[model samples]
Structure formats: structure tokens, C-alpha cells
Target: MIGKKKTDATMILSSEDTRLGPSFVEREEVYTPCYCEENVWKLFERLARDEDEWYAVVISNPSRTAVVLEQRAGSAENGGLVIWDYHVIAFRAIGGKADLVLDLDTRLSFPTPASTYFSRTFLPLDLLRQQFGEVFLKVVEAKQYVREFSSDRSHMRLPDGRWQSPPPDYPCILAPDGVGRFEEQMSITSEDVARRREARGWGTVLTLEEFRDRFL
Candidate 1:
């Protein structure tokens, strides 16, 4: 329950290099346990409504934190770590194959293989703990996050309102009436996240090894 307002740090980290061409084998019930941003907006609206492209990441850390790591929801000699506060993930790339990370609350392999899903799910920013030692990443554009994402789950609530977990039956993902807001498209920083992409031009914010070396 450490959610302050997720991060978007201006999110837009695709320099483009020929993406999109494979993947589409969904049918496990589409998943929805803790709602990783509505299961990555239903895997970015069924693969960008048929091949628009991918990249809707949003791990976090400006103290909002995130721990991940071989997770299925903790335990097992710490093999299944999971300390999240922000962790929406989506990734798909084509042109030569190898980028796939679509994490539906990862137990791994719903699409893993962004170099084995970030070397088995990120956990080596100097061994962690130092305000998460810089993890932030917000790359968007999976159909522009299905037309500028929004969510009124109210950070999952819980301060008398109830529901700190057990949400996501469906409904709640608005924003388009006035413009983005669900905590500025799930923030990472930039003070109060003005929905940058250089002011709505698109997006831009990176790290996590500068976005996995653009395709490791």
C-alpha cells in the first residue's frame, strides 16, 4: 500500500528500429489477479488491435518502489519476490525477434524473453535498496497506451474505503474528456507529471539499462 500516484516520467521511449510482427496466442483466461494496469490493458488491447505495435512499460521507483524477481507472488526461498508499487509491463518487437516481455503478473512465460525477462526480473541496481537505486522507466506507445490511458481505481483504495487488492472486474479507464490523469498516466516523476511526451507530443523517459540496450 505504498502507492502515491504511479509514475509516467513523460513516458515515450521508442526510437524505432522495426518493431511488430509476431505473437498472438492468448487464451489462458486473460489473467487479472492484482491487476497490473488492467493486465496491461488487456495485453494492450489484443496486441494493439492487430499489430499497431508494442511497448507500454512502467516500472517505478521514485520511492514508490518495486522489487519483482521471479515472482508469482512471493515465497519459495525468496524465489518469487514481489514488492511492487508500480509495475505495468508490455513489450513486443519484431524484425529479428527476442523482445517479448508481456507480464501478466509474471510467473514467467506469457511472453518472457527480453533477455529472459530482464535477466530473471530486475534486481541488481547495486543489490537494491537506496530508494530502489534508480529503476524508473515509462515507455509508452502501445497504440499510445490505447489512446492515453486512464484509471480511477483510486490507487486501489484503502483507508476506510476498503479494497487494497481484489479489484479489476472491469470498468475504470477513462480520461479523454479533458486529457490524461490517472496520476498523470501512472507517474515515475517530473514533479507532478504534466503528461509530457514533450507536452503530449508523444512520450520520453528511460532507464532500466536505457531500455534493455534497445534490444538485448
Candidate 2:
């Protein structure tokens, strides 16, 4: 029952569904580990540009390992191929029972349960440690990750100051207005999380298995 949702559940899950609380817009992309960092940062830049109050975030396994999700075999209903390496998602507390997790690339509906999102993406913590050593998985919430994607300085520059690549196309996955609404939700501060982390004694390094057990 943890991952399984009833058929009727799907009907109620939409980008505009109030039951899921609020929703966020996400850009569509062919994800790959090689470019996931840039992609996620780009997404943050997009969100920040559209909504100044939104935070830029990156959540990943301690190892920063990348996993492939092929559309041919693992497409979300939206037909997106996600190669999640340090996957990016948005979060804001909406006065609901819990925080809303907006992961538009998933097979499940947008704004699904955080537990469901983690279950689908992150590998087991124990396995990660075995392969990558005592790395601590972390959540990085930065006040300024990037400028607006449409800004003149938006694209990453090369050592010579040349543009790295063309700016990303407007997000094609969901409406921008819907995604920006989350910026108004209660803030989830780093200090708040740190206090909980200290009380829980998870240490700085958290393995994938441990994270799954604790969060999922």
C-alpha cells in the first residue's frame, strides 16, 4: 500500500488538484548523469526567475551517483526519460499534514507524496555506502543558485567567458503559474532541519538505506 495508489487516486492527482495541495511547474528534459547538475541548477534558475521567493535545491545520494530511467522501459505517464543523478525537486509547507514534493518527471502524478518520490528514485543507502564509502547524503538549500534563465547572464559561461550552451527552452512539462504558487507556502529552513538532524543523531553522512528507512 505504500507505493500503490488506488485507480481513483490517479483521477484526483493533477497539476491543479487542491487535494494534492499546491503544485509546481517543471521543465521537460532527457535526463542524463552527465548533465543532471546543470539541468537541476537550470531548473532552480527558472524557478527563481519566475518567483523570487523560491529556493534552489539539490537532493542526492551521498555518492552523487546517477541512475537511468529510460522511457522505453520506465516512462512516466508524461513520457519523460529521467536520468536522476542528484535529482532536483521543489518543496514548501502548505499548511497541510506534510510538505508538498513537486517532482514533475515521475510516473506518478505531480506533487506526489515525498515518501513515494523517494521510493521511486533513490537507491538503497546500504548499497550506496558499500559502493562509494562513507559519504553523507545531503540536502543543499541555497539562497542564490542561479539567475533567471531569461537573463543575459543566465547561461553558464566558459573560462573565456563564452556562453556554455543555449538557454533552456521554456518549461514544457507544467504551467509556470501553478509552480510558482508554492513560493508563498511556509518556509522550510535549514536550521529547522539541522535541529531535527541533531536530535536524531544522523550525523552529516546519511546512507541511502538509512534515508529511505527514516523518510520513506
Candidate 3:
């Protein structure tokens, strides 16, 4: 792992950090070190400054199955931000620094392994179907599901590059208890899955079956 130390010039502390204690890393905290049109990274930087905890940033493209890992020291310059780009498929540790390294894709809210603070955004697979159309299904092809698919089916692609099809029979399988899978599947449309799910009254939007069940 690349080690960094905190630099006085870049840290921003906040009260949420005190209440959450060590676990208070906001989604935006780890994002600051990276460059993006949106200043999403600033959120995490603020948390790092408040909590005084180190973080790792993983830039990923699941469609390409590629990820980059970098170590940021809590008490270092640049908010101890580090950026590493490489083609690694699974998790691995660097220089015996952190207990683990998490590969965060700011597009999916998957549970990362323990010992590492991973930053990943939740991109509902169902919504992906609506957005990328055909390309969206590639993410499912890239990963193997543990609980979502009732069959050992290995691969599928989305249609129209705008919406991904739920497994032929498993659309509602991811729904909350009492919610029919078919009904839930039918409820999602290409135009609306990305909107705030609470407004639509859908339970927690759509979640990957694997992470939801802790199968992975």
C-alpha cells in the first residue's frame, strides 16, 4: 500500500464525523482525491478531515472488469489521497499496510470485504437496464450471482441498450417480502428507475441479489 500522512492544509472536519465515530465516512469523502466533473470527492474529504481515518480509492469500470486501487493516509497531504490504475479482478493487499483493499465502483452498493473502507455507489441493476439498454446486462455477465438467479444461467444482455431484462422469471425476486417479483419487475421503466425510489414507494430501489443476501 502507498502510505500518506495528513497535511494540515487539506483536511475539512465535520460534526457527522463525531457522531458516527470511526465509521463516519460519507460517500463523498473518498471521492475528493479523484478528478471528476462533479465534486463528489469533496464529500469524502470532509469526512476524512472530521474523523481522522485513512481511506482507499478504487476507480472502476465493471463493464471492462477493470479497477485501480490507491491508498490515502488520513494525516497526509492532499487529504492523503492516492490514485492507482491497474487491471486487477479481485481484492488484494498492498505493502501490508491496510488489513484489506476494497474495489469501489461508485455505481454499485455492494458489500466489500472486511478490513477495508471501500467507496461504491449503488446503481440499481434494474435502472442500469433502463439506461444502457443492451450494455447494462454486461454487468451481470461480468459477475456471478449467488441468490438472485434461481438457475445456473451464466449470462444475459439488456435490450435496446436502454433497459436490462430481469432474469426471465426472476424480475420480482429482488423485491422486499410481500412484494411480488413480477409486479416489481413490471413497475420499473426505462424512464423512471433512477429517480428517488421513496417517491415511487418502491422498497430501497433495486439491489443486487448477491449483496442483499450476503451470498458473495
Candidate 4:
């Protein structure tokens, strides 16, 4: 079941850039399968053991939001055991085979008007490429992650001049090292996010869909 919510159209600005990032909600639409959680965890655990390759697990929220568990092999840049990002929608897990009610799509649905509201300005994948550059794409490709997130997704300006997941969320996980050794660069405090936006100098707000079409 998808969900629909009102679009306030209020966006968070970046301190490093004038562009408005993705919008935030007081509460996110997220759910996990009670029965499959353990099995899913096991699958992830097994994938994590390999130090020469990368693996991931994904989970999607009703509103096109996806969570990714990115595990990568160690590298000269990092020690082994690194888990970069955990909530990447583009690689989230949706139920395909399970015992009870085998469908994850039903449990996940948009919230009506909210879906319509976003549809008017949905973000495209191309924009993400432009904003983040090859570094981001390389990781996705390296992990062989699937596009579980929406085919169209938006990005937020991070404190570092780079674009990243919006505040109150961990979008990308950078694990130069193998699983168990990871570093998070995109997360920020609400105060920090606000401060960064002011630092960058912003003029207006744009929806994910709007931004993708305009700049990306």
C-alpha cells in the first residue's frame, strides 16, 4: 500500500550551495518484514564476509524511499570490514519470496495526494549523476547494486559542497574498506544543515522533481 502526504514545498538549503535540497518530513514512511528480517540479516552477514567484493541489501519505504545496506571489500584507501551506506533506496530490499504474504509492494504504498504532489516534480536519475559525479556512480557499479530506489530520485546539497542525502538521513555509505569498516560523510545535525545552507547562500526552494529537470 502506497502512502500520500501533503507537500509543504519547504526545502532545506545547503550551506555550500544556493540550491534547495530534498524536503524532509517529521516522520519517514518505513517498514521492515518481521519474518524476513532475520533471513535478510543473514544474507547480508554472509555477503559481508567477502573481502574482495561488495554486497548490499535494500528495503523500500512506501513513498518511494529505499534503504540500502552497502558492504564493500577492503582497499588500499581503507582497512577491511567497511559498511558504507545502509539506507540507499536505489538498492533497497522488497519482498520477492517469502512464506507469509510474500508481497512487499502491498505493504509499501504512497500516501495519495502526496504521491501526486511529488509526481508533479519527481527527481530523475540523471541529475544524481551530474551532481555527484563518477565517484558516486563507481561505488554503485562496483557493488553491482540494483536500482531499488525510484528510477527518479533527487539529491540534497551536503555541507561539503558535494551533493548528498538530505538531513536527518544517511543516504550514501562510503566504505573504501571491507565490511565492518566504514565511514559516514553525509549525515548532519539539523542545526548544522541549516547553518551550512546559510553558509552556501540559497535563493529559493525546489522540489526533487523540479530540481532534477532544471539543473540535472
Best by lDDT: 1
Give the alpha carbon lDDT tens digit for every residue of 1-216 in model 1: 232111111213343522333445352445566667667777667665455447777777566667877766667697777777778888776753436676766666555657778888888877774545566677777777778777777777878999877776667767668443666666677542334234243355666666666546
> What clash count goes with each model?
11, 5, 24, 40
Score candidate 3 by lDDT.
0.26
Superposition TM-score, candidate 2 onto the true structure: 0.42
| Model 2 alpha-carbon drift over 4 Å, by segment | 1-56, 61-63, 68-85, 94-98, 131-137, 140-216
Candidate 1 steric clashes: 11
- Evaluated at residue 209, the lDDT of candidate 4 is 37
Q: Kindly list the per-residue Cα lDDT of model 3 for residues 67-97, writing each as its tens digit.
A: 2223332223433233322111122222323
- Residue range with the least summed lDDT across 10 consecutive positions in model 3: 134-143
lDDT of each: 0.64, 0.38, 0.26, 0.24
lDDT of 4 by residue, 150-205 (tens): 11112334466653522223233222332321111122233332343132211212
Q: State every prediction's TM-score relative to the real structure.
A: 0.30, 0.42, 0.20, 0.19
Off by over 4 Å in 1: 1-35, 38-53, 56-69, 76-78, 81-88, 96-112, 118-141, 144-148, 162-173, 178-216
lDDT of 4 at 11: 28
Error of 4 at 64 (Å): 19
- Which number leads on TM-score? 2
